[model samples]
Each structure stands twice: as structure tokens, then as C-alpha cells.
Target: MKIISNKGGKELKLSFRKVLGVAFIIAALICIYFAFLQQEKYIQGNAEYKKIKQTATDTPSDDSKHTQDFQVDWNTLKTQNPDIVGWIRMDPSVNYPIVQTKNNSYYLKHGFGKSYNINGCIFMHADNKSDWSDPNTIVYGHNMINGSMFGNNKLYKSKSYTEAHPYFYVYTPSGKMTYTIFDVMTVNDATVPYTIDMQTKEDFQSYLDTIKKLSTYQMNVPVTTDDHIVTLSTCTNHGRQRFLIQGVLTNIENNNRVGGGD
Candidate 1:
């Protein structure tokens, strides 16, 4: 009887081990499947974006004065969704159409086409001017795990990355403008970067100095009240804190300009 009981206990232990092993295999497979699905979704999204971009570029515009001008097909995009404001492109990652509404929440779960997507469209703060004319235009996007949207935004935390990729471009109906990154920092979501009420030059400069001082990397770029600034804000590890990539409008190529070559 003792021998039989010991044999039964040994068999039970083996069975339990087998069950755990199967469970682990199943969990791993599920994780891989979801990862693949996310990857496919990203690829499909990029393809759609490229298609729209190509069509926009191919369509001729009557304004041939600025031969090197690159303008989004705002007319067509607006027809599909009137909230389409502009497009932003940054190397090594971020390139997407910017959208806006009366409030900031809608695009957090919707794409440029207004389709529901976990990787929400990049959008500007509701209070910001759609023409990128605000003193401090703020844009927000998700820090997706798959490195889509602003997933790679945290790359700016490294000084080397900031030095290598110092500039990004924002395109509006008026023209294309380049912004040189001046500071990148992680701060509370309610910090000064979110403030747009700096009416005085001194006030704005003070705000700028505060952010510049908070930067992890030091930069010599000059920022002035005359310059239009864009702030790209995304989530950091902390729930209430955000990572900000702040840039100053360095150059503008108005569609009306006539004598420049790229």
C-alpha cells in the first residue's frame, strides 16, 4: 500500500509539470501572434499613408512659382475628414498627418481616416492654431510599444540622437517649414510646456529658459519670442509625467517664394 501511494504521488507531480509546460508554450505563442499582428497593422498603415502621399505629390498644382515646394493634398484629405490640419515628418520614425478637433480626446483612439485604431493619429492641442501659427503649438501622440506613432520619441533622451537628428519638418497649406530641436525633457504633464498663454515676450522667454534648463542634453540653439515653436509631447514611464521634444521654427519656405533650389 505504501509503494502504491508513493507511485501515485510521483505521477501527480509529473502531470502537474506537463500541464505548466503546455501552458507556458501556449502563452508564448499567443504573445508572438499578437506581436506579428501589430507589425502587420503598422505596415498596412504606412502603405496607406504612402499611397495618399504619392497621389498628392503627383497631382499638379497651378502654383508653379515654388518648384521645390512640397504641399500635402489638403484639399483631398479635408474632403475625407475636415479635421485634417497638416502633416509632420521626422526621420528614423515619426511621419503622420496632424489632426485637430474642438477638443483633444477624439484622435487619441482614431486614425487620420477617422477609423478606430489603437495607434491613434498624431494630433494638435485643441487650443492650437491649425496653421502652426501658435507661439507654442503642442502635438500629442501615443508612445506605442511597436515603435509606431511617437514610440521612438524617447530616443531624444539620448544626446547623441538629438545631435544627429536636429531637425524635423511640418507642412501646412501655407508652406513647408523646418524646425530645429532645441530641448528634450521629461516633465509633469501639467508643466509649462503645456502653457500657451505667454502673451509677453519676457514671459515666453522665461518659459523657454525654464525648459532649456531642464533638458538632459545641452544645445546652443537660439530661441526667441519671434520664433514659432512646436512641442511634441508623449507619455513617459510615469503616468503623470510626459516626454517633450521641443523645437524652434528655424526656416520657412512659403509656397509663394520663387527663387530657391533645394
Candidate 2:
């Protein structure tokens, strides 16, 4: 604004530069406010998961009381939210309850407690059979900055990291399923038909062949057409790009079907 004094009269007028400066300041404050909210949300989301992990999970004692003792208490967890289909765990940091809903978008914005959370939760593809009977099962999570919820999956880009963490487990109500990591790559999400169902053995093999060619690391793990595979996918820093870690089923324990969804 500018003030002009002429012949005992004073007038005020708006200045374009001043107005533009005020707008810039407003925009900056808005950005800062949203950034603060996002950080707080992430903190709350992490805390909630930590609490859930403590309350809804168990570990076998050294004595090995029961061979069939699953790490996750599905009965208790399902009571909290039936959408939680399974649990995924790796040796130290990568551990979370995998949720599934009628559609793919719900869990991407909601946590295990079904609360609004930008950090989201690890979730299975909506089209996938909860029992994991399908030949290819795809899981999704956000590339959280705090290294939670498949954010660590980005580390798989390093061949050494991939080698060091060779296996991860998915615990269903029925049994514990183990998978060996065979391929890791970051690819354009739009081009990859990640949701395509491999109907026939030949089609499955072809799909495997196509992905293996894109792998950053060639870990010598044999994948056959008959085997079941799980694909862990998360967003990369680049827009419309995704990092994937593909694994083949190597082991199954406590095969009896029991508790929770089929």
C-alpha cells in the first residue's frame, strides 16, 4: 500500500508489490502448517502400530512349547479389525499387519485401526484371494520417510541389502508362509501390469520371465510355474515410479486351516 499527501489531503492506495508479497507469505505459512500436520500424523500412525504390535502379536519361547504357535494372534487381531488379512515380518524392522478391503484405495489412506492415516498400512491387492491361493499376490504400502510400512523396501535396491535380507514371512490364520527374495527393481508403474492374473502355467512363466529381466540383482533362486509368488510394491521418489521386491514361496508351516478369513 502507498500513502500520498497532496494539498492537505491524504489518500491510500493498494500496491501490487505489497499484495504479491502478502500472498507469498500466506502461501509459505500454509505450506509450513501442512508440513507440521503431516509430521504429527506420521508420529501418531507409528505409535498406533507399535501399540498394535505389542498387543496383538506373540513370539515363541526358546523352549518351543508348541510347534504350531503362530507369531500373530489372529483371533485377537481380527477382533480389532477384520480387514487385517495377514501379517508380514522380516528380521528386524519390516513388520506390519497386512489389510485388505473391498477396494484398493481404502487402506492406502487408513491404518490398521481403520483411522485416517497418511502413512497408511500394508495391504493386499483387492483382487487377490485372502487365502493366497492365487499364483501371484501383490501387496502395497507407502514409501514412508520414517522407514516404516515398506519404506525399507526401497533399501532392496542395494544388492547387498537384498542378499542380507533374503527372506520375509507372511503369517496367515492357516499357516506361516515364507518367501525368498529373487528380484528387486524400480519400474514405471503405469507400464507394469502388476494386477494381471496369471491364469495358465505358461502365462505365469512368461510373467516371471518378464520381471526377472528387469531385476537389479540376480539372486540365484529358482522360481517355477507351480510356485506361488508375492510382490511387494511401494512408490519411489520419482512420480509414477515404483520399487518392487518379488519373492517365491519356499516354506509353509502349520498347514492346518484355522481362524479368521479364508
Reference-based TM-score, model 1: 0.83
RMSD of model 1 against the true structure: 4.5
lDDT of 2 by residue, 1-262 (tens): 9976573432222465677889999999999999999899989999988788778876434212222343677888999999888888764366789999999899888889898987788999999998888888989989888888887777778888878778878888877888898888888884453855777998988888888788777688999989998988899889998888888898887654321211
The candidate that achieves the highest lDDT relative to the unseen native structure? 2
Off by over 4 Å in 2: 1-32, 59-70, 190-195, 255-262
Model 2, residue 132: distance off in Å is 1.0
lDDT of 1: 0.78
lDDT over C-alpha atoms for residue 236 of model 1? 78
